[model samples]
Target: MTDHSYEFTRAITRRPGQSITRGLRAVDTGAPDLDLMLAHHADYVATLREAGATVTELPPLEDFPDALFVEDTALCLPEGAVLMRPGAPSRLGEVAHMAPVLRDLYADVRVIEGPGFIEGGDILTTGREVLVGRSARTDAAGVAELATILKDWGRPLREVATPPGVLHFKTDCSLLDGETVLSTERLAASGCFEGYRVILTADGEEAAANAIRFNRFVLMAAGFPATAERLRRAGYEVREIGNSECAKLDGGMSCLSLRL
Candidate 1:
């Protein structure tokens, strides 16, 4: 898999903890219901398997409320995995919890040392180059460190600013294919994705920007009918999944797992 094209064969995910309601969120979206969240997670796992991934569902971590959103802890690459230094102190321990597991799966697992902060949510792979979003969650120092760590891959690191009000870059955009990205009008206008084709989400369907391109399907949040229809018309096999609970906490489809 190049930066943009990911034919994921395996995935690593963690179930939401019972304390998930206490997880951090920029908005006070209502607290998540544990049972409902679990059901959603189960369906997410099913979706991944349907898209050809061998899923490894880790047991829920009771101590970490936001542990279910595991993608923020690390990034899986074709060459190796980079364990990120989370921006939130409450989330820092998550990397420690995930490192051993990643070490077992990846021959080489690199770490991002602080006073820098980085999160997988701020990173976007475009096959030829890696787009690192310098948002409040990810800083220039973190980007520089990641660039150094990824130098062996020889892909230029493209830096982009996260659009205002977006918690992460992918919260408003995701790569649909090697050359095309599905984004909200706000993100498309940001000019962060220069040199690539940007497909604006259907009006009022900004949440669709966070959709994921699983092996053979575009997995997106449910309830965005217009956006879903647009993707279908674009020749994608889009699968709509319920994510109301996660949405309440600012979590999106791509935040739930580490796909590689």
Candidate 2:
């Protein structure tokens, strides 16, 4: 079997004012603090490169400071990539910006154009199957459309409800490996994700919930000291990087880039 390791790259959000105007407003108002967050994103890009993965810095989309917008709108697979239709109307342009980048990496690239909207952040795929979180940001039409595309590649797709109050599917639950899953008690208790072996966090740290696995390594946010330590003790080599800026924009390590 072929190893499915991945590298990640992210575009830094330069003009917060321009990006914020297009989507939901930032909850935090400190301008100086927000600048620091942007700096942290720069550090994140560097960390990925140091880990021996190829890293590319895509130029910021003119006028779309939210152009780091890549995470909300696309998914990369071994064969090709699926361009997502962002649920947020303002974020639709994100797909156009992401297509060329993906094409440069894979030749069989395709898209999920709509009639339906999907956010890449809500989708997760493993060796067994591809799973999508049915949330406000990802609709039924989008899920059905994606299922059709995956079928062509011989990959099965499954859907799980990301009920109200949860961030996203992977945000609450993530596959740690083929047989183990790292999820919060809140999601596991809801009886929504019933089949996977559950590993719960001692305290409620939603930020720690979103993680990206590349080969044998997992990338996580540096700020969550307790949560990071816990995962480290579990025999997983975790790479912690700062993501304060992305967090201000409601983003996480997994949301900053697509790994494939």
Candidate 3:
């Protein structure tokens, strides 16, 4: 089966700081570094366009300075967009703000209303199946509900555990293609991401493992010398953009934006 063609969009927030998650509160939130982080995010978006994708920038959501919210929380599907009820209570408002923006782009927009919480980052799709990771941010009930919503659309859903200490499944892992995945040694060793061809990275290079593959270009951080070389050697045209500022906030290439 052929994968559905999609485009990605992101809101560039004036507040380009690192995220403070429920688990990790010690994250650095230095102020001066934000400009550099915003620049890197712009570069990443530009790289996507260069790779033949149509990227549109949404107006900056300045009210929410930590606006480069994880792309997964703002779940987007081919038929429409699903505004997630962020697992984190503080982030719930983000979905309400994102709904109108997505509605303008898509003919249909929906919501995963909560008695249960779900984040977009926990959801990943391969055109045929939707994989939902049961993480700190996504509940099992959310997954089951999502599965039911997608059933008639021909998108089967699979649930997997994101495991502890990992931000999200896609934060530590991403599918480069139907058969090829880029992941950190931590996730690969867990034996949870088994059954696929996995490319593991070296220690501390796990941040670079979370990348976005749009068209033929791979969006990754600017500084990972060895890992970038490895991807190039594997025949992918890699785009290394600086996202150090976002990194400081626990954000990576895949977290900052959502592709429709």
Candidate 4:
């Protein structure tokens, strides 16, 4: 039988380093508050634990400022894990640092090699199909490599060109459920989600588009009351968590953990 997709029962997260304030961001949202980010990180881990997932916490990488965004380092699959080669050259070390950890937990761990750049945030699997985005962070080479790796899984693949304005495909959209997507208007109009049910976030709540559907509840970014209400109306048990600190560093709920 085919394994259930997005069925993550364990999660791995990292503590924030003092230099986390120097993390990468498209815009100068200003430096993030290390304390607030740490506090928020604790809450994030708590949420995962509350959902019955065993949480593995990694120490802060004092050298990698963006190491807190652990998901970029790898993509956890039912069969194994794909250690990524981050788009930013500076972030490549993250994969190296995470590989050993993954090898300890998974027997079939693989990686994307040179000349191909891929970040976990650019790939979205909805249990039905895999939607890979061609963005600044994930090129055709990267997508092709991923397709090759996923061939054994036998899922339909769609290579969608990410909207120009977004940092990553998921920066503008997220898989809310097997067939439901929460996306920004620009990404929603890209027609990449034509067959799925799309729920657009409220005006100015674009960042709210990035969310994670954990074992039970949906962990959404705080400050988007309208979007939160819309999700609640849809019958999803939504949990709002403050994201202001992570936002300054260009992170969302999805980027904070490697769910497996």
Backbone clashes in model 1, listed as residue pairs: 3-127, 4-127
| Highest lDDT model number | 1
Model 3: lowest-lDDT 10 consecutive positions: 17-26
**Model 3 misplacement above 4 A:** 5-26, 29-32
Residues 1-260 of candidate 3: C-alpha lDDT, one tens digit per residue: 44553233333222344432222222556633656765776777677767665666655555555556548556677776777877776677777776777888778676787678788777767644677888888998787778777876677888887867776778787767766778888677777556777777656787788787776677787788888888888888888888766666566777777775
Q: After superposition, how far is residue 225 of candidate 4 from its true place, in Å?
A: 0.4
Candidate 1's C-alpha runs over 4 A off are 1-4
Per-residue CA lDDT of model 1 for 19-43, tens digit only, reads: 8889888888688888998898899
Per-residue CA lDDT of model 4 for 1-260, tens digit only, reads 33345456789999999888778989896889888888888999999999878999999998999998998888788777888889987798888889998999998897887578899988788868888888888888888888787786676678998888687888888877788999999998878898899999999999999998886779989999999999999888899998899998779999999988
TM-score-wise, the better of 2 and 4 is 4
Q: For each candidate, how many residue pairs have backbone atoms clashing (under 3 Å)?
A: 2, 1, 6, 0
Off by over 4 Å in 4: 1-3
Q: What is the C-alpha lDDT of each candidate?
A: 0.88, 0.69, 0.69, 0.86
Model 4 clash number: 0
lDDT measured at residue 102 in model 1 versus the true structure, 0 to 100: 91
Instruction: Show where candidate 2 strays beyond 4 Å.
Output: 1-34, 191-195
